[model samples]
Target chain A: MAPDQIVFWVFAPVSVGSAVAMLFQRNAIHAALFLIVNFFTLAVFYLVLGAPFLFAVQIIVYAGAIMVLFLFVIMLLGVDREESLVERLRGQRPLAIVLGLGLAAEIFVTARASLGLARGPANFDETVNVGGNAQALSHVLFRDYFLPFEVTSILLIVAAIAAMVLAQRRERTTVEAAGEAEV
Target chain B: MKTPISYFVVLSAVLFAIGSVGVLVRKNALVIFMSVELQLNAVNLALVAFSRLHGNLNGQVLAFFSMVVAAAEVVVGLAIIVNVYRRMHTANVDDASLLRW
Candidate 1:
């Protein structure tokens, strides 16, 4: 096996393992940590796939910014409430079993189909190496995909305003006072 | 030789399934939110893989758009979770599920 394939084999298990660990972790903080592991492995996978621009974004945005946001929320909300893995719903167990079976079937079909389609080294390597992945992507992003690029800012602005609106906490003092008055 | 695209797609499928499991089994709203993020990342991986396969940058560009959308979604989703916790005294979705005014 080439070094590239070797790198992929090594990291694939780690990404899957961390996802599993995140699934079963009781503490929200610990689950977030496991997810960070999963994200880093995903970044590695992006590198392997020849998307260097994506690799950088995965590390900076997903791992750095997003994980920090998750951690901040966990800390702000407190972690004393360690949740259990047992399903509270009536059908979760059976649903999980069905999901697992479906997953296996999907994997089998995907592997067979994709194997025949995309063999060996990727063709993106030519422009990606010469022009640089980020530069090539930027050209396409600006010229061909200008609409999507512009839309990102609009979505971000809306999300920010929505978040601000939702985060405005009503005073607890009045709520507690009302409770006392009711009592 | 580089790893086949199938390997990456298969990996993406596995990750998406794991994320789905997290969303289904976990009751904490925060954990569920993280699981959704995982699912998004898994799809992003698949998109990148196909971009490489086609020798085009569109898939990667779409993945970039996906990441931006996920960031915005996380911001709004966490704010919603915070609102839920503030109102209900718990982030546990079971106790926090009512929409009654």
Candidate 2:
């Protein structure tokens, strides 16, 4: 196989397997750990795409910062693994499965249709500037995509306030749990 | 010359499907959260693949934005999950019947 195909072969299975493990693992902590693996694999994928900056950013921002937050919540909440996994599927599960299958099928169909229409790999020589850094990316992000950039900031601010509100809300009256009734 | 975009697309699609299944089958809120992250990563793969295919960095730029959004999601989602766990003492979706149907 070719080099790019080799890269895909290595990272793709890793990413997909971790994702599956993240789903089926009964332990929340274990699932989060599996997600870290998935994120690292994705970072490798970014590197292969010629976005070295994004690769580092993916690791630092996602695996480092964001996943730490997840770990913190998992430790703080002390969510029970056995009980959490045992919960029965609700009525919406069937619908969710159907929707997901439909989405996957649509993508498969599109892929089949576009089989021979694959575009050539981008020319790094023409796009590469003095240092081959993310020059074009910086230009577009600042110039053309500036509005979306600003909008994302606003969206983040909104999400922050909403999260704070959620975390701070107090329960005026605590209802006794059901399992305790047996004791 | 051997870098076919189909491999990337197939990889991403498989990952996305796994994530969707996780979201559908898992009851633990944390697992569900992780699954959603997987889906986001899958999309990132597709974007990066396109960027490589077109020889432009626009897809990479979009992927960066996606990363930012994912960071925001983790912060907000973790806080919300922690709060839910505190009140309910469990993170099971079935137990989260604040709006029971």
By TM-score, who's the top model here?
A: 1
Superposed model 1: Cα runs more than 4 Å off: A84-87, A120-123, A171-183, B99-101
Top-DockQ candidate index: 1
In the predicted model 1, the residue pairs found to clash are none
Q: Please, what are the lDDT tens digits per residue for candidate 1 over residues A1-183?
A: 898789998999999999999988888899999999999999998988888889999999999999999999989989558876466667986798579659856886968764764654445578554588888889889999999899899999999999999999775698799999999
lDDT by residue for model 1 over B12-90, one digit each (tens)?
8888888887787788999999999999999999899888877788899999999999999999999999888887889
DockQ of predicted model 2: 0.62
- A81 Cα displacement, candidate 2 (Å): 2.4
iRMSD for each candidate structure, in the order shown: 1.7, 2.5
lDDT of 1: 0.87
The TM-scores of all predictions, comma-separated, are 0.91, 0.85
DockQ-based class of model 2:
medium
Cα deviation at B58, candidate 1, in Å, is 0.4
